[model samples]
Target: MSNNGSYSNDRPPSAGETELATDPASGVLFLSDYKKHEDLQQMLDSNKDSLKLEAMKRIIGMIAKGKNASDLFPPVVKNVVSKNIEVKKLVYVYLVRYAEEQQDLALLSISTFQRALKASEFFIPVLLVDPNQLIRASALRVLSSIRVPMIVPIVMLAIKDSASDMSPYVRKTAAHAIPKLYSLDPEQKDELIVVIEKLLSDKTTLVVGSAVMAFEEVCPERIDLIHKNYRKLCNLLVDVDEWGQVIIISMLTRYARTQFADPNADDDGEDSTNKPFYEDEDDIDGEHDPSKEEKIKKTYSLDPDHRLLLRNTKPLLQSRNASVVMSVAQLYHHLAPRSEVHVVAKALIRLLRSHREVQSVVLNCIASVSTKRKGMFEPFLKSFFVRTSDPTHIKLLKLEILTNLATETSISVILREFQTYISSNDKEFVAAAIQAIGRCASSIKEVTDTCLSGLVSLLSNRDHDVVAESVVVIKKLLQTQPSEHREIIIHMAKLVDFINVPQARASILWLLGEYSDRVPKIAPDVLRKMAKSFINEEDIVKLQILNLAVKLYLTNPKQTNLLCQYVFNLAKYDHNYDIRDRARFLKQFIFSENSKLSKHAKKIFLATKPAPVLESRFKGKKRWVPYHTILTPGRLAIMTCLLSLKFLLILL
Candidate 1:
């Protein structure tokens, strides 16, 4: 055994080295690590699993402390063959940490990990015989987390037995285990399906939510398995824990969407008066489908099962859990007849008053639905108004909803709200406000002049984004009725000197060029000013300046002839290829002697083109606005939320 007196820099100290006796800080730490490594090697080699487990933990502790435990890889990899699952778990964990660097050693553990994966004997005994239900439930929960393919039958057996267990706690844990069991060995899907069916039929509401959740995951397409359980699920929808309610409601929504006729298919496009649904108003309790008496009376248009599902879900609109409310909101959104779809709006508006994040999600749902149908959101227009505490994203979402909800009656109110947004310091948001102003103008023609007047006023706004966005809005308004808006075009032309933003500069140039006669005096001077800064201007402005110069020269070639020749010659040598190419084309077109096209430069450049068809950007944005997705139950998210609930319960 070498003494600790002299340490080798290239090699670790021998297992015989005791205390660190080196001079340098790194040598001392290495020597100290060698001694611990030697102790760990001894502990790992012990026949006692406890000692090996302790060594595995210490290695993990070292790794956690940001120390290099890669030296322990070979020793730890051997323990993957340990009979104790806990010991194997720690060993495999250590191997995963350094598997890339220790490939040969890690490969040695794969067969063992695969073989050990089939071994669940350790948890089975505790899960089966533990007197404490929590211990039994937890044992089964832990057992489910084991990724052993061979343990499926044993786990399935345990799940089947636990599904019928007297304690709801054990049954709930078993219900949760169905997904893990299916994940470990999906071939056992047939057997797991039997188990899920049994769990769904279990009388406990707590177990039912999880059972439905598992059913959705393992056999989501197997709606037939849930058909008999449909009435039961509708009855239990509100009774499940808040987390369970989200899952059950979401499942019911999917089931209803597939199972029933589209509630609005028969309706002509007339305003269906919202049959007002207040909390607990004529609410029927008990496991009742639509009664024979109601069916004979033809009291509802939706199928009996659909109506039953809607009735069962409608009251939960008031659930404190935002997710629960959203789930029900989705229920009404996809399945409710138009008359009843409006019922979910009040609840959605209430949610916008939640904290910033909640408002953001709920606002999206409202936006989507508002686009689908308008009046539902009109009443809550003020609720979507920006609050001082609202973050920039929340403010933008609110602005989108406000614009989507614009009616002739609401347009005045919404445009007034946009005025406030324009004045805010948030540049991105201020720009969106300006764009929304254009959308509002586009959506409602009655408010065209009103929105244009608002935009023209914002051209003088100190914020560059506000001024820039305002220029775009004015152009769109002018495009709406180009001839009627000659005055607005002239007004934009007058402000060209104050607007310096690239897009704003380009926008002014485009309008003046498009309607040059409207501002004949201003157009020539604007082109010369733009020409002075042509090299420094953005690509977009430069392109517009080129087009404007061509248009103006074509209008009166003799007057702009020198300006054209000079500008084209300057652009010809510019660094940008597109600009240079465009310059060459224009210069040739204007001066070509035998190039027949040059003779008709005025006919070519001054030809009147139709106004561009403005696609409602609001229409594109409306697709993302629906909050339905945020509340819709996702497969993995359900498990995560349930796991969190379990963890919280254990903490309590």
Candidate 2:
């Protein structure tokens, strides 16, 4: 072996190598040439630079070969961590490649790595919190992969320091790392609570927001802690100047509802159905009795069943803040798992009866919640059920609520409800109803076809954004319901011609990709409309339109040679590197024999290679307007056309 990375040992074969050690899975020899190991160990111990480098390469290769050669990393870490600067740099480069190439082996040497991590104080932070953002980010990633319980406090300290770090990227990376620590040790939930307290007080909005989100991830399992600290957590909810009250309240609610689950019920334990929390002492059946004298044994294995979090926290449902009220209702749904259907149903009704804002918030929460708790659907559907007799606000709120509940569980009911609303001739309500149905179509095929019947009328409606949102909805619906709904789609294609907004134009073209073979019957015309959008659109819109064109070509390669032409043109002339990259991806996607786009693969390589000075000048400019603006030019053109109008369009 030499410094250039090659095997160097000259020793004879060991007995382990003479006999084949077959693996059960791959049916390959478990051990290879033992002389390779002998030479590697000798070179690793050698002072000669060439042999040492050869040892480094051999160690990496041995680890790659799935041998238990990671026994050498402790010695390797001891050697590398003590080396001088140039040697240390070489060691780091090697370790990083090893970390990247054979992460599991590195992980196997956890105690060895931890010893280096704890002793060489600089390396931990260098990887996790270096002033160089990339180094800090990459180090946190490696540390997270290690998953040792002892590192929790160390990781927490780093998180606290990162909260105040100047770079948003570093802070965001730190925020992500906080959850990874919990993944390694769920018992660190209390430490996470402390981190959340500091994060909520931090000066940076991103830090505070990230901390609140991290709390939502780690704090759920500690519902008893949240129950104990309800007043304190809720007090923070009252701090008037706080901008993240919604997230804080949402976390508290999620914890109350989801995390404090009874493991007995979860695992179908026999004792789960026995009402352990509220058991009447005298009513215990003799047959079901365990040792009556047994004391309550404590272990972290089961979370304390804090049913009181749900039972005691109901008053917050009447709190003035809509977010608080909504969260309280959501919490009841989780904590009251025994009869949660009634609990959520009643709380939602109470919220609806009091305030419009509460109603809207509760409605959003109920959409997804009701889907999971579909048995509660009938009662909730009736409570917010859209009717001519109801107030317009109630009717509008009901439509939104029904739209929200249209996922896997409740889509069938939502479809049936849509027919009832569409059968009536109230055009205004009918339009709103169709939009709600659009929301449902994405989740279920039955509802998508039911809504597809109204596409012709929706396409002709005066409201363009409703039509546009409907187009987006139909695209999603077509994905699941394509074979059965092909005729309805042919009608949708005729309506596609009426949509002039470039955003809608691009969306319609993208949707056609789902039915790539049926582009002729669907919206082949949309490809041309989307392509034209690139001519005068802002660079951002042009980029999106270019993506849409590429997607269309990819979907139905039979009709769209235009994708290749679009890419070739951009690669040759687009001023933006991103635009050139889009062109490159299009070229590779169309021409590469493998044809699969590795999503995580770097896109920059395919990006237009920089033209030096021109690339640097345009580097940070806002390259493109949003696709919605391209779709509806008039709305963007208007100065005070009421952003409220846009809001209404969005809910539709």
Candidate 3:
């Protein structure tokens, strides 16, 4: 390594590095001699099973690692795509993983990637469309991983073409492809509705599961279109398949809960009497308090008349399916905040207290619902207070949920509860309390102040989720209270955390962006630390940072000169237009700040007045003349007669 410690910039050999004539070994022109790829190709082609499989496996790993083996992919994909069935499967797996995990491959031009995707079509049909049921099933699984929209039309066509295919698996895979297609275009949702409506009636369980999952994902957006066919969807929710049941019930209960919460009713309670379903009454617990006006304000903002929704929520709480029950409990926990909220709150407490598999879902649901409802949250808080010493995942889950759900109004109570829990000296219990306090750091001024020590304690959590969640909370607090959160934000900046989970680096970068102000104070080393991560981040995160830079520039232009420079450079050279567009738009803010451009921009802005372009174009243009003009014979005859009569009268 050089003193500068910079990586080498040597260009790898092109795919055509080896010419056919020059290489005596395989006589293949495009093969590189140094890699001996030609020899492996020959061995695989010679029908030596052991050697072939070994070579395939090694190549698979190479492809996965994206070996400086660029010259190898095109030939490898071409040769293996149509080879033995096993070879095809292995190759497809490598390519799919390449698309999914390897960010470097995103640098490949769109056209090249499209060609590789098109190559997969040959296998897609064999895996999804061939006579062998297993091969076809395997193909469907692979296609789901492709994540390309262009394949949607082909998959949709296959579903239509193979309606009578013998394999139920094939038919089922075809049905599943429809929503995956529709997810790319919401306009295609109606078309998916048609496809799913047909598949819901299929006798096969696989088909039923596929159809129900599609409806669940798509229906939230297309519910109005499916209103007429709602019964069919509702009936399918009872199918014997567990997954089908989970999805359908989740969709139904969620929609029903929302509708019940916001049922349109006449003032003076006239509509309630007519509609038995829309009952407006107090909650069963009757612990409702009017003292917490902020709670009521946030609750009513989400749903104006909780009375009707809470009335209809009874059956959902009683749902036989665990998922349905959980979804309902969650929706109510978040949306239902009247004194009657104890109904769902008690239900969640019972579910949590029971140590069921659905306990976490229930706890998270309680957290979601109780966020703004102070008095309503009090019962849950009291339940947790008593259950604090209980050594169960349920207890831990409850603590974690309550921590996240704390708002400005509830933070004081939560902090008091945490202080009480500290006496127990149970590390995990204290950890849970600390983590929750971290989530609410920015929620209240006092919470922000109190969370500092807890957040410091949590920085060493071995669990990445805990650490990352703590960082997120710290970031939120810093963004919320930049001045007072200086120390805490500074503490968070020194952390060099690497989360191996995919798509998470973006969020972590977002946290950095949120705390960028404290970069100079808490961590003067933030930019240098995150430089590599920013380059390796996904487009979404890049856009987020660009946006954050714009926002920072908007608030404090002088401090953000370096940030603006980075944004402009990225906008000019970034691989994607989305990044470019964001950078370009953000540049306007910086440009507007400049005194010279400000004058020019104002002049251009004022001078570029709206013009009547079409009207001006028509100014000197001739009007259209019909090719064969009609004389209006009858009208002309009447005019002549009138003229003759007038002349006779004048002569007389």
lDDT of 3 by residue, 1-652 (tens): 1111110123333567531112122223222332567655654454444444545565665554456444444444443334367666665565556543433442232223233233444322433445567566545555544555655555554555444467777667766666656665567666666766666566665676666676666665655544443444444444435556556555655655545544322234333222323244433334545565356454343332334334444555655556656655655544554445566655556665554566666665555555444455564566655264465666676675566456677677877787566445466666566555655664455656667666656566676555655565555455554666566554554555555433344544555455455454322244434434566656776776565555455445576667567656855677888788767755764565553433343233223223111111212223465645544888678888899688556534
Model 1 regions more than 4 Å off: 1-126, 148-157, 267-300, 585-652
Q: Which candidate number has the best lDDT?
A: 1
What TM-score, over all chains together, does every model reach? 0.73, 0.39, 0.40
**lDDT for each candidate structure:** 0.74, 0.54, 0.53
By summed lDDT, which 10 consecutive residues of candidate 3 come out lowest?
1-10
Residue 117's C-alpha lDDT in candidate 3? 32
The alpha-carbon deviation from the true structure for residue 319 of candidate 1, after best TM-score superposition, in angstroms, is 0.8
- Candidate 2 scores a C-alpha RMSD against the true structure in Å of 26.4
Q: Is candidate 1 or candidate 2 better by TM-score?
A: 1
Q: Which regions of candidate 3 are displaced past 4 Å?
A: 1-40, 48-52, 62-88, 98-128, 140-153, 162-168, 179-193, 200-205, 212-220, 228-232, 235-246, 257-325, 331-364, 371-383, 386-652
Pairs with backbone N, CA or C atoms under 3 Å apart (clashes), candidate 1: 364-625, 364-626, 364-627, 365-626, 365-627
Error of 3 at 421 (Å): 4.7
For every model in order, what is the number of clashing pairs? 5, 8, 10
